[model samples]
Target chain A: MSILVSNLSKLYGDAKAVNNISFEVHSGEILGFLGPNGAGKTTTMRIITCYLSPNAGSVKVEGRDIQTESFEVRKLVGYLPEQNPLYLDMNVLEYLEYAAQLQGVTKLMIPRRMKEMVDVCGLGEMKHKDIGQLSKGYRQRVGLAAAMIHDPRVLILDEPTSGLDPNQIVEIRSLIRNLGKQKTVVLSTHILPEVQATCNRVIIISRGKIVADGPIEDLQRNLHGGEKIILEVEVPGGQSFEMVSVQVRSIPAIETISLVEERDGVKKLSVETSNATDIRKDLFQLCVQKGWGLLELHREKTSLEEIFRQLTAH
Target chain B: MKFANIKYIFQKELRSFFNSPVAYIVIVVFLVILGWFFTSNLFIANISSMRTVFEMTPFLLLFFAPAVTMRLISEEKKSGTLELLITKPVREYEIITGKFLAAWALYFLTLMPTLVYYISISVIGKLDLGPVIGGYLGLMFVGAVFLAVSVFGSSITENQVVAFIVSFLIVFGLFMLDKVLFYLPSTLASTLEYISVDYHFSNIARGVIDSRDMIYYASSVGFSLFLGTVVLQKRRWS
Candidate 1:
């Protein structure tokens, strides 16, 4: 395992910030940490990065104990904290060189390492500019450059794309995806689409507890059960909404039918089934036998957002 | 244990000090005040000497040292950069010592200009070498103790003003303890007098380098730094 957290707990007075959380992150895996605000996602990331010690239990990076051998763990982990703090007084290149030095980069390697980071983080023109002068997107890029300057084995990012415009978010998301090819990345974001687009596996935390942990496909299938199918039908004559609802309820494997709309003798119905098995054929045959005109039929997979909401909802 | 990490942090802190107006302001203000005291006293006493300058430095340092050291750790805490530094491969003591050394180096730089006073005194007339050297060494001791206290204060709060105030109160308390000792019972007064920094500083300012005085200053630095390391570690615990 690249990272193993066993029975980790951190408490702030009576409230448990992270309660007996246990998980493992293997090498070369881009793991998404999903949670609501105050759900202990940042706390867990801090513990793994050795920024905060757990009140109980242990965390190991590359089989090194975080408490006893924190320096070794620190050498292996690169972290971009939640707000992406940087030395605003220093220029981008200066701050990266400082970070590189702390990471034990030899003096001769610093310029080469800095050049690589500037190119990768797209801090081309802004490398010589003071951090305080940069925009929020550019500052976050500087923060990422600092985190990746040492080129450690694992990267733990907390809300890396937060507070960014759409274009910036996509840019950073793809950058993270590219970096994941060589490093074990654990990033936390509530943006479900970002996780879906980038991470192959995810861990959803809720109220200091792990609600779900698995690959994308397994999580969708296990927690959400199945897919959502939408059908549009026009009766030969005007059919009331009640008729469609009653007819769709009788189909086996159909769990729920929500009426989306009904207008001009055309009705849109959203059908949910119990498993991964497709029930569109059964619905189509039923519509055909009933002499109902099937205008459109398509399957909408349950989105990660819906699964996240269902798992984290109180 | 890692010299490179310490050097990096030390250089960063030193650079940050000079990047803003704080370094120039503090150094200028310090020299101006010290210069005023030295020139005015020399004219009044009609004596060509830096003896009074050395004697006046520790009391002056009680105020000026906090100004230089107040922002050292508190600014990092306020800006959230402390989190980044501590998570690096550097040890907690390395960060604290790096900051301490930087603040001390700046204090030494500010004090270095006062050597002109010494040079002028030597140029103008016969200057006693013993007290001048003792005074410089004593000033360093005072600076180290005050820097340690200020760093401890900075570690406890994110507000630089609060850090200055708390450190001022601490160094001031230690400085005034010798005077306050007379008000206590004789037995307790004697012990408190030994613990007072001014007691030891005055002994050194008189051109005597007692091992006891050196021990006192060393212990103060060690104790304050030990507390500072604990304060940094306490953040992880809390």
Candidate 2:
């Protein structure tokens, strides 16, 4: 495991900010951390990066305990905090060099390393400008460059694209994707589509606990209870919609059937069934025996958004 | 504990100080106050010595030093950059020392122009060099103590005003403790006098190089810095 967080808990007075959470992240994969606001996502990332200490458990980065071998762990992990904290008085290049030197990048390597980071983060025109003069989007780019300047192996970004415009969000999203090819990336965000677009694995945290963790596809398959099939059948002019709905609901595994629409002498039906059951073949055979022409049969699984809402809702 | 890291932080802080207009303004205000006292006393006492300048400067430092050091850590905390600084591989003490040295260095620079007072007095008449040297060294020690207190104050909060006020109050309390001791029992009075910064500063300012006075200033700075580090550590845990 590139990172192992076991039984980690943090308390703020009487409140449990992070309660008994455990998970592992491996090498060369993008892990999407999905959580609502105040769900301990940032708290967990802070602990993994060695910025905050846990009240009760241990975090190991590449087999080094974060509490005991924190300097070594800090050397291996790069973190972009939630707010993207930066010095407004310093120019982009100056701040990046400061961060690089503090991270222990050799003096001789700093210029080349900074150039690479500036190029990768696309801070071309803004590198010489004071950070206070840059737009929020550009400042975020500067923050990213600072995090990656020393080229740590693991990157932990808490809401890396939180406040960017739509265009900037896409740019940063693709940038994160490219960076993930070589580094283990863990990013937390409320944007579910971005997770689908970028991450291979997903961990949904809710109220200080892990509700779901697995490959995205597996999560969408397993955590969600069922799939829905949209069926369109050509109807004889004399048949009523009630008869078709009754027929579709008569199948053994079919849980519910709703009439979607009627057009061009065809009736559309939505069929719900338990997960892991393939009813399309059964429905096709049923259509042939019923002497109805099946025009369309499409399967739609539960979306990640719906699954997230279901898992996180009170 | 890395020199390279400390150098980077120190250079960054110095650049930050000079980049803003506040440092220039504070330095000018400091000089104006000192120059006024020197000239006003020069005409009244007709003394060519800068003894009056050294005598009055420590009280001015109660306010000037805090003004220079108030934003050191408070700005970092307010701007969220403190988190970035701590997550780096450098030790916490490196940051505290780097910033302390930078503020002290700036305070020394403000003291630099006052050397003209010594030069001009020497040109007119024979000057007492021993008290002049001792006075300046005492001022340096006093500045170190004030800057350390300001850093500690800054570490405890993210508000610059709060830092300034807290540092001012602590330094004021230390400066006034000798006066407050007169009302106490005689035995307790001497111990409180020993603990007061002004008492030791006065002993040095009168052309003395006592190790006792030196140890007082050193230990005060050391203790203040240790507390500042503990504050940062507490923040990390909380």
Candidate 3:
């Protein structure tokens, strides 16, 4: 294991920010910390980074304890806070050098690591530009570069992709995926698709408790009731819509089917199944036999919002 | 505890100071105020001592120190950058000490141009080098203590203006306690006198660098820096 958190509890006045939460991150794994607003995602990341001490338990990064061996644990973990704070006066390279030096990087290796981080974060063009002049996306990149300057074994990024446009989000997600190949990464975000795109496993937190934990597939299947797909099929030249709908309803694996739209002899239906089965092959074979063109067959991602609402509705 | 970490923080802080026009504005205003006082003492009073420069600086530091340190940690806290620095391999003491030294260094540099007074005096008249050097040393210690106090002030609050007012009130008390000494009984007078920065400063400014004065300055700076670290650590536990 790379990071172990055990029974960690933090209290803010009378309320608990993190309550007896425990989990572990294996080496070379990307763990998405999924949570709604005020769900203690940032608090957990803070505790793991040694920025805050747990009220009742401990965190161990690598083999170093956060409470006792924080100096060593700090050396092993790199943190990018929720705000992605940076000294806006300094340029990218200057801030990276400062971060590297603060992390106790050797003087000889400072320049080498600085250059490597700039290249890794795609910050070469903004190396000398003042951070305040850069856009939010570039500033976030600088924040990432600063966090990775010391080349630590574990990276704790809190809402790393928030406040980014779609294009920037894709760029940062790919960067995170690349980093996950060699380091243990715990990325926290409320975007469900973000977790699906970059993380291998997810831990959904609500009201300071771990509401769900497992692979993304398991979480969706367990709480969501079923997988869903949008199927758009073209009607045969002579057959009516009734015939196609009847044939589609005959498939036993599909428990529910509803027509979402119909126009110009093309029909869009939502298919929901209770279990993970490759029904696309079955649907395609049916379409081939019926002489219907498969206009579109896209799986719909189960929204995490509904799961959070169901769990936290009380 | 690591000097490397402290150095990094120190350099970053110093860069931030110079990057804005605030540092230049403060330095220029400081020089103009000190220059006006030094020249008035020389031409109007017809005095040739570094006494005026020494006397005016501690009073000037009442506002100057707070202005220098008001944004140090307070801005970091407000912007949430303190978490980024603390989570690095740097210790709490390192962060406090680094900022303390940066503010003090800026103060010392601000005092540099006052060297013109000593130079002008030596060229035109007899100059007593003893009090001049001792006064400079005393002023440095005084600035260090004030800056440390303001750093402590900055750590306690997230608002920069609040930090400034807190330090202003504290150093103001330390500066004013000496003037009211004659109004009190001898025992209490002596106690407040010892606690007052102006009392020890006068002692050293008279060309006497007593170990007691040195001890007072060191302990004051140490105590204030310690309090600043405690404030920062309280945030972690809280």
Every model's DockQ: 0.80, 0.78, 0.85
Q: Which segments of candidate 2 are over 4 A away from where they belong?
A: A232-240, A247-252, A261-268, A281-296
Q: Candidate 1's residue-wise lDDT over B85-161, tens digit each?
A: 98999888888888988999998988899999989888888888988888889989988998888888888889999
Q: lDDT value for candidate 2?
A: 0.90
**What digit string (tens of lDDT, one per residue) describes model 2 on residues A1-314?**
89898999999888898999999999898999999999999989989988899999999888999999999999898889988999999999999999999999998999999999999999988889999999999999999999999999999998999899999999999999999999999999999998998899999999999999999888878876777999999977658888887877777787888889988779888989865588899899989988899999999877999889999998
Native-referenced TM-scores of chain A, all candidate models: 0.93, 0.93, 0.87
Interface RMSD of 3: 0.8
| DockQ value for model 1 | 0.80
Instruction: After the best TM-score superposition of candidate 3, give how far the Cα of residue B156 lies from its true spot, in angstroms.
Output: 1.0
Considering the true interface contacts (CA pairs under 8 Å between chains A and B), give the fraction that model 1 also has. Answer: 0.80
Q: What TM-score goes with each of the models?
A: 0.94, 0.95, 0.93
Instruction: List each model's interface RMSD.
Output: 0.7, 0.9, 0.8
lDDT tens digits, residue span B21-59, model 2? 989999999999889989899889887788887878888
Q: Candidate 3 on B1-238: residue-level lDDT in tens?
A: 5687788788788878898887888899888998888888789877778888998999889999999899999999998889888998787888999999888888888989889888988999899999898999999999988999999999999999999999999999999998999999999998999999999999999989899999999999999999999998888888
